[model samples]
Target: MTQRKRMMRVPAFPNNAKLFALAVVLALFLAPAPARADVTKTNVGGTDLQANVQLVEYETSCRTTESDSDLIQGIIMPRNPASVRSVYFYFPGNTSEDAAVHEGGSDPERVCNPNTDGKTQFCKIVNNNQQFAVVTFNRNDAHTNTDNWLDEASDIQCFLREARTKIQAYNMNPSELFVSGHSGGGKQVAWAVANGGVGFSKTIFWDACYGTQCSSTAPRDNAGQMYLYYRAGTDTQADAEKAKQENSLKTKLVETTLRHPAIPNGCFLDPSNNDLCGGRGEEKGELVVGTVEPPFPLGLVFDETQLIIQQPQPRITIPGLQFSDPEELRQLIVREPDGSVYIQIPFLGQYLAAVYQWAVAAAGIIAVLVLIFSGVQWMMPGNVITNILTKAGGERQEESQNKAKKRIAGALIGLVLAVGSYVILYSINPDLVEFKSLRIPYIIPKPLVETDEPVDSIPFSALPAGAPDPALLPTAADVCFPLTRDSLDPRRGISWNWGSHRDGSDSDACEADSDRCHAGIDIYSKFPGQVVAVADGIVKDIRHVSRCADGWGAEGAERPGDGIVIYHRSLGLTFNYAEVDEGTSRVQEGQEVRKGDILGVASYCGMLHFEVYQGEVDRFQTLNWCPPGGIDVTERHQCATQNYPRPDALANPNDVVRRLEGNFCR
Candidate 1:
């Protein structure tokens, strides 16, 4: 070994070279290997796609149990991180079990691999369109209760933040962001846009939007493009139409013949095909889709029609020039190359009006200031210092005094003119001082008073041929009583008589011109109970009348409460069921009801101010005369015009009461 070493040691290696060799050997043996990215083979509509999936964890309060940690998992498939152009977040529909324990286990492969035909289309669309997809899992327990995604808006925001971070880790800087949901997931998508503030330019709802959130302008204003997809004839369709009506500029309703669960399959299979997935799929409404400039120039084009400004053109009037319509004004404002007018400033009239007002106010202020200065000069004719400086007295001082007197008189005249002009203009017409164009007052002609035409009252003969037997309970023949017999017992202080008013005043006598006469009968109960509809009718109106304070039917202690008015088209009469609890109203305006249907619970005041009108009369005619009852000035005015005991159509309800008491045979 000594001989071999001597032979090889002809040259010596440097210290640096020896160190480099040793480091290489150590690194090869001790260094850890690079980790492999998670890759999954997703079968999307018969096509196997290889995608780099990541399991991202985020903090959220949306959980099945309070003891459960805030941690939640989301699935992200960044097909090609370097080439990602957009990020599409998908919220799956409600599950029968907690999303983590569903059929696909915690892996969420049902949404990732997209086990369903409809879900597979989403994956395929994302994979083929250079778009990264993210799927969020919800903590819904079928056996317990399904949670609303809208209720946990904060959770949605947290998930989005974490998902974006995960995408960035793959070196993706997507220029566009998108959100989509199915069924309950649709609510999630809406909440994200409404409250998440995640800068999603495009949003889609699939068979969702059954609530008022989508109909709101906030989401539509936030998203650059919004598509509401619904199965034909579903509530979702109706809501989508409402959203379209509210935000016609941004919202586009896409109706499909496919079932709710299968909508994604049909719509996502080809998003660009208007006849297949777009609004034209079912050909229900007009859906205009074309390229247009975005609100801001970001070098990106959108697949939406240009916003057509439908604002009415401003009215322009000039002393010398008269323009017939807005087109003529536009032609006058903008000039052609040959010097003909062409362009228009829509706000010209408003601008000029504002300027005129400012000028008038400024002139008025200057006149008052001049008047004050003149008054001060006239009171202090000449001070000692002024006399010494002028070195004049007697005749000269008198001349100066006279000059000041003249100036004061002139200033007074100017002030009077300025102040009087405003007063005169205001007296002539309040609108003149308002600086607005004069408008002819529209006067509603007074109706002719007919002395011979008598008010129609429900006759006693109108009741079934028998006396009201209190012993007999209301039957099917009676349809329904205003108050159940149990709640209308005589011992409970309620009676079949109609003489006293709700205010405990006599309501028997009526004067033609008196507005204080009671227009309805007051029925009181000892305890609050169900108030049923007496006859099948359509609800005409509802009102908040008075609330209970110290106790039921207490004097001078009631608050604002609720009432309902129903129009019995068959009977050609309106039934005013007043003083019901607002929180308990079971019917809405225009809703049709059958006899015996519970209208609502009586107020805690235990009073039902029941009125029967001979014909269809809304709250204006029926409730206006009552204090603290009219909703608007028009209704209040009607109270003065149509005095109480409404002479034209008021009816006595004794016969009606008999019929409601089961006295009617048919």
Candidate 2:
């Protein structure tokens, strides 16, 4: 108030206008500075090249809530900026970024030297190229050693866009942008071309396609984008072939006998030199393209004597036992009883069971605490004389006593209900309350033996004395046996007859009137084998059928079992292979399968229920046709109108079984 401090009031403006002015001022102060480039002389390969090194901070789509900025150290080397027609963006692989630039190495006074004094394989190729500007970025700033490209895809796209602009500032306007990466970097290039929303002219994979990278949908999605898939003769060769087959026109597969690490450099160098490049024999570095006459024969045969050097074998350590093969580890983890292993409950079941156990324990503790609280209330002091003198106090005391009694009664009731329910469940079935892991036996599929001779070429002398003539009998051309020849023996394998009740139904009639009539022949095996496809067909449907109490034994009652339905388009027939082992299906719905391809192993009960239909009848559609408990009168009936086994599509599988038996039963 001391003379009002000679107050000078600033002019007031509208709120929106003030906000706009504030935003402008803040933006000016907080906005990122323009990327500064330091030009320096760097020796690459054998030539002295001018390199423009820049540290760029770019806004990335790594987070959705707010803008996030990331920094990358990039080096651009151009022989002639004016003559540049394309820009190659190279994303260095994990840990390889160190080879490009080191800390404190980007100063104007320092020379940008390659890690090996410009003698590295990659440097050799970089110095050879003159028409394109090679821009290499260190992604280690944003993503350290992580190989997943999806995490930094947005950041990469942002950097590329900014890089193009920076290159243009140097008086170079490149029309085409190419991306290439080695190993982990290759994964990045693949993702960028596939889903980065950037228009990359070409992508080069330097043995980068590994694991799911080979199965990437990028080739299919980017049909027009050109891809050069380089494979080092290793695990990735098979995967690379899959990607090339997706789009043969735009994709090329190149194979080299080099190992995974040496592929990037060896691919460009001539294969004739045995020193700098490893000993290049014939077909060492074969370039296979789509136009090549015969596709490059995959699975190259290498001279083991020349290649595989004898080394000291590492001793595998198992806590309690020693195993020569890794497959033996299964014996320790998986619980196998009587040559049968159990199929584990799904993840959801395990999670729910854990939650249920926790809930039960919590409920019991809460009930006990409630009882304790009630006991404390009962122990609280109350004077009889004082209560009687005051009527209101007496009534209050009475209410307190009643509340304690009610709480005690409620706690007791809760405990009884919890314990009684568990007891009842236990009495009904011990497994319901045992809380032990569910052990549903998983039938292991018998291994298929490969042989040079075909089944048709089998000598007649191999057949049993009473066996039918091999030539006269129906061959696998008609239908391959579901089980192997060894699995068709009555003693060692399976045994079944047509029109026999698997549920042990006493009814002699195989008519629809008898609900207990067996719909198909049941092939019972003491030890089951893999179930094979009956004919060449497409898998139409996969089903899960719950076992009825009357069938088999009560042990598997209400348990769901797997079933497969395959439709032979050429034959116009549908084959239903039921009671397959749960979780052991080798074929999927809509997958094409040839005759003798494994469908799955037999069921836990060592049985296969085989059925046939005249046309394309889905197994699921026939579920309602004469279903257990009968069809509802309120709904219209299609195949259930007649009686039990009512579907007219149903065809006796006896004839087919008899023909297959001749081939396998010997």
Candidate 1 vs. true structure, TM-score = 0.35
Residue-level lDDT of model 2, residues 190-304, one tens digit each, is 6565544444555556567766565463332221233434544666666667766543334555665565545545543331122323333233222322221111111111122
Model 2 ranges with Cα > 4 A deviation: 1-34, 37-70, 96-124, 141-153, 173-176, 221-233, 257-261, 268-666
Per-model TM-score on C-alpha atoms: 0.35, 0.34
Model 1 ranges with Cα > 4 A deviation: 1-72, 76-78, 97-107, 118-121, 139-143, 148-153, 217-219, 269-275, 278-280, 283-666
What's the C-alpha lDDT at position 152 in model 2?
A: 53
Check candidate 2 and list the clashing pairs: 512-644
Best by TM-score: 1
Instruction: List clash counts for every candidate, in order.
Output: 8, 1
lDDT of 1 by residue, 9-43 (tens): 43232223334333433443354555344334445
Kindly report the root-mean-square deviation of model 1 from the true structure over all alpha carbons.
29.4
User: How does each model score on lDDT?
Assistant: 0.51, 0.48
